[model samples]
Target: MLAGSAIVFGGVFGFVAFKNHMIKQFFATMPKPVVAVTIAKAGLTEWRAVVPAVGTLQAVNGVDISGAMSGLVKSIAFESGQDVRKGHVLVQLDTDVEMGDLRSAQAELALARTSYDRSATLLRSNTVSVAALEKAEAELKVRQAKVAGLQAQIAKKTIAAPFDGRLGVRKVDLGQYVQPGQMVANLQDLSLMLCDFSVSQKDLGLLGIGQAVRMTTDAWPGVVFEGTVAAIEPLVDAKTGMVSVQARFPNADGNLRPGMFARIEIERPSGAPVVTVPASAVAYNLHGDAVFVVREDAGPDGKTVSKAERAVVQLGERKDGMVVIRSGISPGDVVVTSGQVKLEHGSLVSVAASDPLKTAAAGAVR
Candidate 1:
């Protein structure tokens, strides 16, 4: 009875061991699961480094047109939003009183000149004293000065444009009384636009006059306006440690306006071709930056299969959703741009139909 019991137990244990071995063999024979990923070939791109900053748009010439003297508005020669030339008469103040004073002064000056002439002739003939001739000359000079002053006063009543520009909304009506230095309207020369921005003092060495700058404003979507660095402030702000920069963009279409907020990119000169991949391909970590390079290898069945291999890369400038690979990668290398999270060293991978890098470079809808 004991021998029969032992034989039965050995048979049961052997059967369990055989079942486990068969299960392990089945899994080992099955093909490894491949992680589906999107890939792009590393390509050469002209990498131009850029310093980014936000700025406010302004005109090359801008000012607030103001009244110089207190008077009633006689006439408004310019309409709001009018494009005007330099010296264009914009507002005319009531000058009736000034004109009247000028006429009286002119009449008095005429009489004084005649008296002076008569005095000079009499003195030459010994009919008048030299002091009388000198007194007549002095009165004539005073009258002349008074007339010139009245003319200047009348001229001040006529307000004209100081430069060629577009006028903002008129602040006063025809019959409104305006005081000295009161704002009448805003005048801005829009032929050329200026963008004022600030950059950190540490980046001051990267900026220079004539460096290409690209700008965009929310008012104009997808439109990139190009300009050049116009000027850089010599002194850096002590409190903020930033340097002010101005860029000049030609506005022949009059599209750019003052006070528009803009995003600015000061582009450096193009350098030699560098290897680049889509920004998504880079895995940033505290240890280092890295990218997954896809390589081909033979499977157990001798079929070629693609696998992901992680490569440590030194990064450079990044722009337009693409990042420069300064080292550890070269052009024409296949890189996994997406689905890298599921991959490990030597993990089998299959390329997906859609490539993000190509879509980004062409700006196409994905």
Candidate 2:
């Protein structure tokens, strides 16, 4: 048994030795890679850092017009899908009974007023008692309140647009009875639109009320709408880790509508200085972000040659095809921006006069 164990150990050791020697020989015989690449120099950039988010378009003043009083509809004063001004009557309920009540109350109020006047004069002349004058005055007030109450009831039967807006399709027909709180139609004030969007809670510090924003919609491709931030929701969404923001834009041309899908960009003020490179410079994989930095070396002919040195980089926000580098590179370093597919650590690179190193845009990153 001991001899068999020794044999197994020796076999394993020989195999390991052979594998190591072969690996060393393969590396020694490996050919160095040569590649052509575009290069860019890292530089200080200070610009607004923008975060991306998707949002929904909404109406600033929108509601479902509903009935507050139940009654048979006398008439629809406005047409469906029409523009209406504030106080424009939209729906009217039958108020013949209330009108009659109002007339009766007015007549009763007149009679009550006459009685109070007589009683008051009589009391002053010491003919009627003070209590009689008081009773007549109380009756007059009751009559007046009855008139007011009846008028209010009549007014409630007439539903008017509360603000200037475009009306939706009429839901209640003329002479159709509707119950209290039953929707008559939808009214949306479309002169101005409200857009509600959300951003990460971490980005909340970069936003504030009244900041300007540029918005785009799939409905109108290539068209941009501008607005200012109207509100920021006080709480972050627990499920999304994002905070909701609202912006308002003028719709004078009537191009924008509610419920449209929108994309928004909010350019904040200048932030701290940073370094950035073209998006093509970044090599992203499951490992992490990296770039190829061009370095100078002495070739076999004792001449300077450019080599690509693979560098792992820490990155920040990306914008407009540029990425902010947090670390692992310095200003004036030549970084391979494109054509890095055949590149590896210590690979030779060719940079022509036409492919001179590009300096990062000034104020292009923040």
lDDT of each: 0.89, 0.86
User: Native-vs-model 1 lDDT?
Assistant: 0.89
After superposition, which runs of candidate 1 have C-alpha atoms over 4 Å from their true positions? Answer: 1-32, 126-129, 200-208, 238-241, 300-302, 354-366
TM-score of each: 0.82, 0.75
Largest lDDT belongs to which candidate? 1
Error of 2 at 88 (Å): 0.9
Q: Root-mean-square deviation of each candidate, in angstroms? A: 4.9, 6.6
In angstroms, the error of model 1 at 62 is: 1.8
Clashes of each: 0, 0
lDDT tens string, model 2, 300-359? 779898999989999988877778899999866778888888888898989753233245
